[model samples]
Each structure stands twice: as structure tokens, then as C-alpha cells.
Target: MDITHRGPALPLAMMLALAACSEPLDFDLRGRMGGSVDTSQAALAAVADRPKPDDRGIISYPNYQVAVARRGDTLATLAGRVGLPAGEVARYNGIQTDDGLRAGEIIALPRRVSEPSPATGAAATGPIRPAASVDITTLASGAIDRAPATPATRTTTGTTAPAAQTGVEPVRHKVARGETAYTIARLYNVSPRSLADWNSLDKDFTLREGQFLLIPVVETAPANAVAVTTAPGTGSPTPQPPSASAPLPKDEPSPAAMAAAATEQKKEPVADIGQSQPAKSSAAMAMPVGGSIIREYSKGKNDGIDISAAAGTAVKAAAGGTVAAITENTDGVQIVVIRHPDDLLSIYTHVDGLKVKKGDAVSRGQTIGGVRAGSPSFLHFEVRKGFDSVDPMKYLQ
Candidate 1:
């Protein structure tokens, strides 16, 4: 029998053989993947470290301070700019007052020139540059590479230390034996991917004992966002930082009452309900699914409440909102995030068979998906004011 006519079968057999191979292919055959090419290293190598001098050409470190010479500056000219005597400045660095100086060259000071301050910024070159310094362990273990090196604030010793600049500074965490990156991220209420990116973990997200990792910073809503409703005579209530210790008041007003007050005023505030007080007055969020509360909110332990339900049970929206995002977790469980009025967010996780896509407008009690089938099937429901997760029970009427 002639087999030359069956040419298509040969390609199919080859594909099957490749799929059945014991070793998997390392490189991608198709070229549609993103982030596969990284230019960060090349970009970094192109830049050279330069001295960050203050207005007086002063660069201060913990143990010492130096003055940088500008272009076309001589030793005497540099000394005059920093308000120091030419003889004193030249003598300290063992150079003659008439010696030619190079721009960007450091000249040691005989005494303390100036104290580091927020205005002066951090040093350009030192053991800890305000820009590139990150918490790292010994050289034996991999060093943590915090992307987009965060700026540091000056300390009392004139050295720069991590501090809140635009957002909160990351917390330094030391890795313990037998602890994985996933567990550490969970402990701090951050995503494992974010933790990995901030610390530049290995491909397998590996961590070594005694390795220092920087926990990603989370920026929460501002204090002013808590005052959503204004009581008749009560001035703007004081905003308190959300703490796990302070439980939501059980006797707080219901969402219906708050809605009624808002109706009377003919204006409803934007939906930023960080504290229980605003949640007490805002429109209540209906339950997402009919089930028993299997787990309650426990701050860092559990950001949301878990409601037990049968697999494939219908999951509905807790409040009217625009679908903000639909994403999958590391375990492939679906997460649906909805943005409600006044900047409130309702999050439903462990969902499946989503009927609504991202950007869909959903009404209160509207069905969005079904509970994912699995052992101990349950829906995780969360209510967040800005990025801060609040108690879901407080928002559910």
C-alpha cells in the first residue's frame, strides 16, 4: 500500500510524539507572549552613578560628608561655593588650594558641613543610595531587587533610610526556614506575584533562609474618604485608622436609614465607606449567595467572609455597580470585582461560569456567576473601601 498520499497523518503523528515526550520544551514555539524580553538590566547598565549634591554641593553620609566639584571649578572655587576656606578644604583632602579639580570628584570636608534633610534628598554615592538601596541579606543568598528603586528619607545619622515618599514604604521581612513566598504574601495581605516582583524572586518563587524580602506597600484610602454622610448636627466625624482590634459596632444604623437620610438631602455622597459609620448609613449590600457563614472576617487571617454553598449555586451581586475587573487567582479561581458608588468595591471570589464580563453594569441581587464546584464549596465575599478591606458583614444589610 502506498503511504505517500497520507502526508497529513505524518505531521499529526509528529505532533503527538512531541506532546508525549517526557521532557517539555523550554522555549516558546509561538511568539505572541509578552514580558518574555526584559530590557531592565541593559537600561540600568547604561546609567552611571553620579553624586547628588545639595545646593551647596554637599553629599552627606552617616560617618562623613563630602563636597562635589562642578565643571570649570578649581579647588579654591569649590571651597568658596561651600562657604569653607580654600586651605581648610584642600588640606583635608591632601590637595593644594591651586590644584585642578575634576567635576563630579568628591572632596572630603574637615568638619561636618551640613545635616541631611528632606530638602537635600539622599546621597548619590554611598553604601545606601537613597535611590537604589534595598533590604538584602548576605551575598551567598540571592539579593532582592526592588524595581524602580524607591527614594529614601534622611535619618538622624545623615544616612538615608526607607520612608513613605509617594506611597508607603515596603516593610522589610526576614525569611524563615521552610516558609514559601506564597505564605509570606498571604500573611501580609498582598499578592504572591507582587511579593515576587518587589523582591525579584526566582522563576520558581524560591526563597532561602536568612534572605531579606521587602513586603509590597499597600496604599489605602485617605481619612477624608470615611465621612460619606453628614448627620444633621454632628460635624464631620473623626476618622480613625482601621484596626482589627476595633470591631464594627453591632448597633450601627442600617443601610436603609442612611439611604433615607441621603434621599431627604437630595444628594448621596460618593461611596467611600472605610469606617463602619459610613457603612451604617450607605445603601446596604445584599448577600451575594444564599449560604451559611462558614468563616468570619479575621483581619490579616481572612480579608473577607466565606459563605458555604453548594457547587454551581448561583452567585448574585451584592450591590449595584460597574464590573471593574474579572481575574483569576494563582489557583485559577475566578475573582469578580465591582466598583459601586462613592468608591466602594464588592469582591466575589471562587466564582465560576461568569455571565457578566468586566465593565458590565450589574444591579443589586443580579446573578453574575455560580459557585465553583469543589470540596467544601463556598463563596468568598469582600467589601473594600478604596484598597482597604473592611468587614463584609457590616455592609450586608
Candidate 2:
């Protein structure tokens, strides 16, 4: 049998074989076997160490307060002692869910006390008890007198925590470790923006331990009800700070509730496809998928807009960004988060399949996934500025 000459396979094989036969260069290792990192600064100088944080009863800072977590002090107990919400306290310290807090670590408490508003003369609303600067260990020691106030048992004496109030004593609060504007606001039933404005702080509203802050209080009242009081000559008003033990207001709807209401309202009708603006033609954005919006974002309810389309349709990135995460929720819905410039983030949810992975760099119109199969086949889209969710319409072109 005669062997016939072929194209490039024979030459390629020979070249690979030759390359494999060559030996890699090597260097002698005897002299370098005992190598060690050198640290000879001043010969006798000690290594630098982080400055220790205060681990005493309570360390105060700007906007929040902190205490060294002691034995037998869980996050719940600590939060109660400070007259703040347990969940809010845990969140400020980066704890999620009902997990127990860490011992020996610093804990941030809310701004329970604040200065009286100049116009109101009272501490915003009703009297706020003294700031929560208690020693968690002592409070949690099962002593009845030292036990902190719980949500169910919180009380206000002399000056009550009714729907409305007036000028009270100025209350003060010391900042604690790991506290932020959002957590502090939640504890006091105030808006983070408002808190920052009251303190003349920037939008960032940063907080530090040991720093003091003037808490701005809000007094809520029935719009129709009018105050009927005697003339000033009768007697002086009672002196009490705003109620520190007051729980969340009943009339104040939660963020989720408000968002859910908005979602329900929008569900009545879908946006017209013809009126649906094309991302490519509009601003500097791309459509994640061609579909009609089934749901739009409602602040506090839905964080992203929902688009419904045919099953297996491609989902593209709305803008150029790096893939930050790819996750699936308990409902088996796939989500992809992309980090963009200027501290912006784009999120795609309810995706059926993904074309990219976490950390992938994609272009403005790159396909990230496909819409999952559903009765209507839909996906959720969101744009966030930093950690705050913003409306997608502002960025979607």
C-alpha cells in the first residue's frame, strides 16, 4: 500500500514532538534553599500593630455608640439595652438574619438621644429616654432593674409617646463602631437623608465611634385634630426628652409594603410595546431583552422593572460592566449583577440560562443570559446607585 502525502498534520506532529523532546532550563537550588524574608528595620525595632479599639463598657463616637461585646451578651440583648431595635443593631454591625453576634467585638447602638430642635424646643417628638450607653454584660446578667426595654415592653413615662408632641429636653448620643446612617435612621424611625441634613452631614452620612450627634426627632399628629391647651400662664410644660423606647409608627408603611402597593397598581396594565423605548436608540443603554414591561419599579416594593417576553430570548447587558455575581434564589430564579462605572450596578433576574459568568467583562449589548421559561416569560431588571436602588427608566435607553 502506498502512503499518500497529506496537508499539515504530519509537519505539525513532527514539530510538537521535537518541541517536547527539548529539555527546560534549570538552575542550581543548593545556594537558595534556606532563603528567608528579611526584617531588619533598626535591628531592634518592633513590628507595627493596629491601634486597639476601646473594649470598655461603652465607647462613643460620631452619630453612633459602641460597646465591647462581653460574655452572655447576644445582639438581641445588647440592642434592647440601648433601647434600639435588635435587627437594626445587628445590621449596622454587618450581621444578617438571626445569627448570634460576636463576643469581644465592638457593637454599634442607635442614636436614641438627640438635641432638641430649635423651633420645637422639645426633642423632636416625645421625650426620648437617656441614650443607650449601658453595659450589655450587666444588662444581660438577668437583673430585672438592669434589663433593657424590649419592643413589646417599651414604655414612656411622664411625657408619653403619642402620635404628636413638642419641644423637649435635648438628648445626646455617642457614636458606636460599625454603625451607618441607614441603620441609625431605621432605629429612630427617621429617613437617612433627613438625619444627614439635620446634622449638616453630607449625603454619605458617615459615622464613627465616640463622636457625639444631635438626634433630630419628628412628631406625628392626626392632621384633623387640633391641640387644645391652656394659656402659658397656667404652668410650665413638662421636661422630657423624646421617647427613646417608642417602636415603629403604625401609620408608617414599610418599604416593602409601599413597593408592593406600587407593583399591584402597575399590574393592572402593561406598558405598550410600541411605546416601549428602544435602549439602543434612547440613551447610552441597551435593552436586556425585547419585551413589554410587565411590572415597573416602585420605591420600597420592587427594586427592578419586570419585562416579559418569549421563552429562551437572549438577555443582554444594558451597559458595559464587569460581572459581579451570578446567583440563584430559593425560587430557582437566576440573577446576574453587573458593576458599572460611577458606582452603578445593573441586575438581571429570573433568567433561564446564562452566557457569562461572574467577573466577566461584557460590552454594552453583550448577551448575558436568556429569559427563563414561564407562562409569560419574564425577567427583572434593576439599576442601583451604590447600594440604593434607582429607577431603571433613568438609565434604560
Candidate 3:
């Protein structure tokens, strides 16, 4: 028998044989379609919601859009995943195509590719049937005709009512460099677990720089909430009222007593010639470094005083306190934060060769580090009460 004459039967036999095999082959007998499937809808569906980002890491805001990178993602990889050209994505973000992205780094989109979708959850893969082969409009109309929908409602004025508001909107916080989930929670007075849940943090509660986090809703404001008072490097003229620190232990001498004992007094009767006067002591706080003030505190300008000092100059603690946190800014410069009495915090920046670590007890004028070397070596000193930045000069004396 000539197989060419039985083409239809041969295909049927082949299909049956394939189905009977241990693993059936998944082949489309329709052959390739002449027209390409449009993927534009899929791209738009990926970021349908406004303001709130989608699971694909796309943030669809009204004015602009952005994307958050996943672990081990590069600009090129992110571009492919977000359906934008790699060059455009890289140029928009001011990074190279192959730049490795921090897990939560923000990648700005140059242009809007899709409008926000009100729909949520997974997006559709593609059109159910290829547009080239089917008359979808005719099929949809037929299906609609067969469907039964004989219900109607009307208001007194014959208008539909608007939907009520849903849950409360949360405050969005951008994770800065050196910020941890715990520190952020503490700053907002929310439990770490709550923050993690709100942000979908991993088991380790890890946070990445530039990642957006939604602050949990609470009945009351946090006790120590950090106000968006002013950007760092801009000083606020009006200092926040200071809160009192915990009372010192009963056995320890008060700061005043320590100060008084530090200064030597003239004995009423001169001691024997061989005897020496008490060694002179200093106050509870002093200048961290002795240098000319290159920049004074200015509200909305300089957040701290810039003291021009020589490189390697010893940086001292301004008061008796414990190191609250040791962090670095985006520039990688080291910052030392010390918590002192009276709810005071002193920040020392641009310092290197740290001698003390976080949580270490430091006394007044103790050496903590040295000034970092630069073209114009200076120590950036800041005094903060609670979460508000204040003039360091007010407390430096």
C-alpha cells in the first residue's frame, strides 16, 4: 500500500502510537501560525495596579514606574524580566548593562510601557487562541448571547454608588544604606515581625538598600518615631525637646559631682612641698576635635558642623555614653552614633580606625577613632535629641 495515499490515516495512527508510549509527546499539529502572537498585553498585565507594585517587582505609580531587582539580578537580566530593552533600562537607572543589582535596588523605567491594571494576582500567559486563526469577536459575541444575565438594580436617582474605602494605607519607607529591619522597626516603634510581614521579608528579615517597605498601621504614633524632619546634611534650626534619660544607679556619682571633682581646688593649707595638687579633670562633654569650624550648622543646609582637622587627629567622644550604632552611608564613610544622657545622641562621621565597637561604654573625651584622610580632612559632627537633629555647637562646650 502506498503511504502517500493515506496521509490522514497515517497521522491518526501516529497520534495513537505516541499516546500509547510511556511519555506522550506534546506536539501541536496546527503547524506554525503565519502571524506573531502579540505580547504587549502580557507586559501591561504584569503591572496593572497603581501605587502598589506587582509581584514582578514593577512599581506602577501615577507619575512614573520602577522595578525592584531580585537576588543576583543584573540590569540586563532585570530588563529581560520586565520586558524592556536592556540598554534602556540600564541608561534609565544610570548603571551598566552588567552591573550586579542589590537584591532590592530600584531600577527606574525610562518610559511607561503599560498602564496600571486594577486587577490583581497572576497575569494571563497569552491570548487563549492565536489571533491569526480565530475570529475572537464572533466567538465572544456568540458566547455572550448564550449566557443568561437578566438582573438589574437602580438607585433613587438611577446611578451606581461608589465603593467604600478598604484597609488603611501604610506609610512607605525606603530602606537606606546601613538600615536593618530591626532598626527600622525600632525607628517606627513597630514589632520586627509586623514589619517583616508587611514587607514580605524573608525568614532572616533581611532588608536591601533602596527597597520600599510599608510601615504597619498602628492605633497610635510611635514613641520614638523618626520624623521626615530634614534630609541628612540639612540642619533643622528648631531642636526637638529633649527627653530625660534613665536615672543613674544610686551608687554612682552624678554628672555634676564628677565634674566638680575633676577640677583641682587650692587647699586651704598648702600641702607639703613634695605633695602635688589633684590632677585637673574636665566636664561631662567636650569637643570631639580641636579645629576651625569650616562649616556651621544651617537649617536646610548643613546638618552638622564641619571641623577642619588634620588627618589622623584623634576623634574623641563628646560625652560619657554607649555606642548606639556603627554604620556607613552610601558613600561608605563610617559613622559612629553614641547615646548619651538626657536622650542625647552624638554622630561622628568621616572617621576611620575605630577603636570601639557598638554597645561599648565610652567616657568623656575618650579616643574612638581618627579623622579620615581627604582633600580637606574634617570631622562632621552632629547632635540629635531623640530623632531630631540639633546644633552640635550647643552641646560641644
Candidate 4:
């Protein structure tokens, strides 16, 4: 498969539209998180009749969309989906990282910014003014104004709760004996204000054991397990090098994380997007020694392109960049890492007789290393951005 012809098919705009939907989706909001979503429309309808986007064309809680909190849903897991800082989520949302989340309680996704809300903050519950319209049209959108809503007095009785104005449905929770306001809030993974607003309880109201209480929530679920697929690590030339340490293991990137990050962070490969159009740069690029690609790159299968060549074949620089690191792995294979432009890194693994040292400036087509003798004479080439790896074919040319 000539991946140069293949490109990132997922457009950026479509993804943003999906994330901003107001209704519960039949799909997992974190689809790349690697799990099924509670997409049942019946289950969704029961979650809450989330208000329609107001005149400003903004969804409720402009900062976030809600989901039924599931077992294992934590601030950290939620942060992983969009690379949120865990500490900020904990402090701003008043949630403990280790606290267990109640199943079926409302939870919020990664809002552009974390802020206190009537449901979570000390503010009393009432109708909050709609947030500024989210103009997702511009790829360079600004941060959401996540200011807390004005507080309202708590409802005295359950007939018309304070949060009722916001259209948040309540769940019935029978307060067990000796249960206090704080204990009840933790059990449901909800803020005390949310619990009080639902039942219209006074801030200082005492709860009797076994008393029934209503908890408030936005339907949300546990963060799904992010699927990261790595190709099986093939052994390089054997025997330890006297000057080099053992080979350090490397992990390939997952297509799911890659795609999701592309959607969320706009780190998509900037390459020729046309499948039928030949690579304009491939002709200008230098091959890392001419060899047939033994293992082609696959999104969910292989991490990078593997080219098979004779032992000791010279491995040239795919492109000019700074020699970032010349390290050995546990297998004694000398791996050359080059820091390139555009937040990209090119890795030449399983090579020996390295010509470049750490911090050496190399030019394009420079001989940085050579294949090792007495082992599979193949070069493992990878391209990466920050933490996520991508197909080298996109940029090798």
C-alpha cells in the first residue's frame, strides 16, 4: 500500500460539529477512547430532555456537554480524552481524583475551560443565561467564556426544585442511615450544591438516615479506554556494542489516538491529501538506501514503515534536522532520533555504526547510520508529532 496516496480522510470541520451536538448521541462521544457508547435513544431520552440551543444557537452549559456518569469515570480519564490537565479539573470542579463516581449520574466532558457552575459551585440553582455563541466555523476558535452562572435560592420543596429552571432531571437516591450531605454528594459524585438544589434542601439542613434524596446530574459516562496499537517489535542485529548501551524499546502510535488527536488538536499530517495524485516530494526525497518495503504502515497494525535492505546498507537522513539523540536500545541497536521542523521527529531504529552524535546538525540525505550485520537488515522509520506517531510516507518525500 503506497500510503503517500492515502491521506487523512477525516475532515476537521465534521468532527467539530459532532462534538457540539446538543442531544445524546447514539455514538460514543469519545469514539477513539475504545468502547461502546450508551447510544440507545430510549436511554438518552430518559437521561434528560436537554434544552434545545437557544436563540444564540448555543447548547446548554456552553462549555460542556453532559453524559451519565458511569463506574470508573474520573477526572483523570476525562482529561485523557482531550489532554486536560487533571489538577485544574479537580480543583476547579471540586472533584477528588480518587473518588468513585456513581453510575448513572450526570458528568461533563472536557469543557474548553473549567469553571464552577450552580450544579457544582456554591451558587444556588436557577436558569443561567446562555453562553456566547460558539462559532466553530473558525478553526482558530477562542476559549469559551466559562464564567459561573448567577446563584439562585434553593427550592424549599421537591415540587419545583431550584435546578428545575435549568431543565435538569433528578434521580432518586434514598439517603441511608447516618448519611450526611457531604457523604451523599460523594456517593453520587456530585457537588453538594447540585444535591441541595435537586431536593431544595437548606444549606444547613440535617438529613435523617434512610431519608430519600434527589440528586442532580447531567448525563455522562466513564471515559473509555484509549486504544493504542503498536506493531510487534522485531529484533535488530544482535550482540551488544562496546560503546553503546542496550536498545531502548519504542512504542508505535495507535490509529485511534492519532485520528482522535488529529480531530481534537489539528495535528493531522500536512501532506498531499489526494489519494490519486502522486507525491510531489517523493521524487525530491532520498531513499534510506533503496530497498523494498517489507512491512507497510497500517493504521491499526504497524507503527511505521519498515524497509528491508542488505546488512550494512547506509541509512540516510530522510530530511534535514538536528540530531536529537543517538541512543542504544536493550537489543543493542543504535537508534538515531532527529528533531525536525513542524513539531515532528524522525526516528531511525535498528541501525549500527552511527555517524552522527547527539546534538549534531545533519543535512538532508546525510548518512546518519548504517544497518547492523548478522540481523534482519531492515530500517524501522517513524515520524512523530509530540507524543503521537504518524506515517512516514506523509513526509518522507
TM-scores, one per candidate: 0.34, 0.34, 0.36, 0.33
Stretch of 10 with least lDDT, candidate 3: 125-134
C-alpha positional error of residue 89 in candidate 2 after TM-score superposition, expressed in Å: 20
Candidate RMSDs in order: 25.6, 30.3, 26.9, 25.6
In the range 1-397, model 2's lDDT, one tens digit per residue, is 1123666786577557646842221122221234332211111222121112232334333334454455677777766654568887766656643555444444555554332232333222223222321212111111111111121232356452221121222235456786665555545545445455444453345555654444554544224443568688897665332323333224333455444433432332222233333333546456788879877777544567778788888787787666666776435667777766655667777677687876565666667778888766677787766545678888875
Score each candidate by Cα lDDT: 0.58, 0.51, 0.57, 0.47
- For all candidates, what are the clash counts? 4, 31, 3, 15
Candidate 4 lDDT tens digits, 84-185: 676655554456665554433333333543233343431322233211111111100101011011122346663532231233334456566566665566
Kindly report which residue stretches of model 3 are placed more than 4 angstroms away from their true locations once superposed: 1-284
Better of 1 and 4 by lDDT: 1
Candidates 2 and 4: which is better by lDDT?
2
**Weakest lDDT window of 10 consecutive positions for candidate 1:** 135-144
> Where is model 2 poorest over a 10-residue stretch in terms of lDDT?
139-148
* Number of the top-ranking candidate, with TM-score as the measure: 3
lDDT string for model 3 (1-397, tens) is 4556867888788779768954224242221233342221221221111233455666554345567778999989988877899997776555689988767555667776554332422232111121111122221222211111221234469874221111223456767888876667656656555666555566667666756676665543434444667788898766432321122223333555434323311112122233333223444357888799877786434556788899998888776776766776444577777767665667788889998886666666667899988778888887766545577777765
Model 2, runs deviating above 4 Å: 1-282
Model 4 scores a C-alpha lDDT of 0.47
Candidate 3, position 247, lDDT: 28
Pick by lDDT: which candidate is best?
1
Which has the better TM-score: candidate 1, or candidate 3?
3
Tens-digit lDDT track for model 1 on 337-372? 776766476778778999887656666666789999
